[model samples]
Target: MMHEHIEALRQRFLHSGDDADLPIVDAHHHFWDLERNYHPWLRDVPRIPFRYGDYEAICHDFLPDDYFARAGNHRIVKTVMMEGEWDPRDPTGEARWATALHQRTGLPSAMAAQIWLDRDDVTDVLAAYRDLPLVRSVRHKPATVPRAAHRRDFSAPGSMRSEGWRRGYALLEASGLMFELQAPWWHFEEAAELARDFPRTRIVVNHTGLPADRSDEALAAWRRALDALARHPNVWLKISGIGEQGAAWSVARNGPVVRDAIACFGTARCLFASNFPVDSLVVTLDDLFTGFKTIVAGCTREERLALFYDNACALYRI
Candidate 1:
């Protein structure tokens, strides 16, 4: 009987055109007006080619209108805007800007601002973010990818295990902000340790442990990381950014990764996201969500609801 239900849902999910009727709370995505905000990576594109070369297509001002236009075919009820790397000197500037956009446009239902946790004024920064009604979480994306992987390591030597970073992480629960962590699989054990030590703190692991290498050895490491982190009830996974893993954007290619991740974390722990603009470098918004819907076709409608909206609402408190 359960197998019959699963197959029925799969049939509906596959045949459904656009799936535009379903409500979506985009757990991750970004909104940036490049002219007003400063993104170092976006600005420095010419000199340093990002991992996926020749990204001239997405080099533009992507605002709320642009996002909704891109999302015309889907019922995106809400979005949690991940902090764009606004100028680092005034760390809270990005959140403030995003808050104002939320007030004016009503697009971003909530926000996750970026903070340099190791800095001295971190508490003051977190406090200001807390003042904004829309701010629900914080992200401090340090480089966990080893230089041996031929990627730049911007994080301090210890990554999540660094003393100062831990000190700052301790403050999030009290401040009403969850931590949004973006790191490679190598740092998952450290992330698991962080989750255990600060069980009070809610952490959302970004980009599905960023299985960027995708070799059999790399996939094994990524799975180990996901498995370890899923042990903590407080730790949740935002399943997006598979596009950056060097695979072509297609349901056929991405299905295995998505299916395995959901199996690992379960529907209750998984949050669906577009990772737009950043992910737009690889595929269009429509293609991304459509592919995602197809990949999870076997899930029951209730499970699909949790994946698309309910889980995001609970995790980010949206």
Candidate 2:
């Protein structure tokens, strides 16, 4: 039934002649080999607490073929690979693997490599990433983010407020790379501070600040944080991962979040991404994208093109 519904939705978008053939540069996604690499979250005995609940279904190797198969009707010309949590011992290992994967697959035109900002070897890791041609940015999810409470606390060892993390973050400009920040809305003010301190480096917030709570008050708080962060011209937003726990993805639930994000960041500073494999736990590729297209169906063709294609290319240099 869900597949039938998705097909119907896909047909609606395909029939919308204005932007049906719009080329897409999937701003974010992932490919992993559980056999070759040690992803602690996926391979560990106890699964780490995930936003999408139990994700055992995706525990196997997810290579390029898997991604291509799930891409469905969307004409995904290019993609930006987000770093999966690979072995932390050798931080540059993921980038090397992705570079090799791209050589064979010719997908993931760019990559956001993993780098622990607070690690002692961060300087060397950043240097290694700079040498990898596919690496366009790096991700280091800050420590000590408040989950249940919306309170601000940046004193944790690897939090964005930490001196060591800031030192590593400051080097991104010199390395010619940007940053991928994955934190909840409550942390955006701290992120805004990080953005202010290092004005030269670009920071792209992951998962729309993880707006998981869709309550009226929660959304208002998310919007306030977005407003604060958007004030910093260096910050950008990705409209993906809006799925709710234990619920199917639909336009009715996610459309407002998408539209609000674009309104906050504007089309130029906003990009559309699948956050695939991770988001696939809640939504299929076709249905997820169909929701994106349908929600913005009333917008101008140029605006739609910017969200779906142009912005990603420019932001990631894909």
Candidate 3:
């Protein structure tokens, strides 16, 4: 499926916009050592059935050089490393490894380290990751609504509404760390409610609301959820991973999602990211950014700059 119209997609979404030369601060991406990390999904599964179906192409090592080469024309001045779930028991290990990469390669100016928010020792974990030089945010894959395409349901029952989770969430305020969230569109209202409660703590939603169900009804619901979440000033939306879950990853398919998110959150509160390697299973970095550039082609230079770079730098404090 990827090979059939890939050339056509490259041609159609390939051309860069006026701000093509502008430096990009890739807000969401990962660097992993599958050997050192315990990523069961990447290690045990031979194929990724959902998010990025049959992930063989991207299942191997993807270091800094590989990412830079794939980024192609875009000048990736800096990036924020989204913590790949490595050894759940050793959450800080991922940050330490990424920080070493930062020293050696100088990419991922910030680290969004993962923490088990439901754990009793979560506060200590937060303090540990927060003190790391580049660590700016904490990401815990919140249990999102289940989709038919998924092989396993990783969502914990009543997590978003639970008292333990909210208590852990409050710790982010003390650590000065933002929350990098990942969940289905069905859960946005709960997310919005969290944003309202934690007005001081920043929350960045992953994907363009992760519209897994693409029916007109589903899209409308996703939009309504976005509207609800957008009302909170502390929340920001990340326009990446568009194709990661949405099987039909193309300019025509994703343009509306990105445009709608930017419209919903406005340029100031919105950001662009490359959910790379994971997204690499669907599209290349060049194609991803190219598609994004095409989506916002009609906007002014400043707005384009804001989406492609500035907003991420400010939000992540990179």
Using all chains and alpha carbons, the TM-scores for the candidates as numbered come to: 0.89, 0.93, 0.88
> Candidate 2: worst 10 consecutive residues by lDDT?
2-11
TM-score, candidate 1, is 0.89
Colliding pairs, model 3: 51-244, 143-155
Candidates ranked by TM-score: 2, 1, 3
Pick by TM-score: 2 or 3, better one: 2
Best by TM-score: 2
Q: What is the clash count of model 3?
A: 2
Q: On lDDT, who's better, 2 or 3? A: 2
Which model scores highest in lDDT?
2
lDDT tens per residue, model 1, 32-139: 887867888766646455556666666678888888888757767678999877788988888888888888987688989889888899989987876887888889
Whole-model lDDT per candidate: 0.80, 0.85, 0.78
Candidate 2, position 43, lDDT: 93
Model 1: lowest-lDDT 10 consecutive positions: 149-158
* Stretches > 4 Å off in candidate 1: 1-18, 45-49, 147-158, 245-247
lDDT of 2 by residue, 43-143 (tens): 99788888789999888898888987887777677789999998899789999999999899887799999999878898899888768989999999997
Deviation in Å, model 3, residue 98 alpha carbon:
0.6
lDDT of 3 at 74: 74
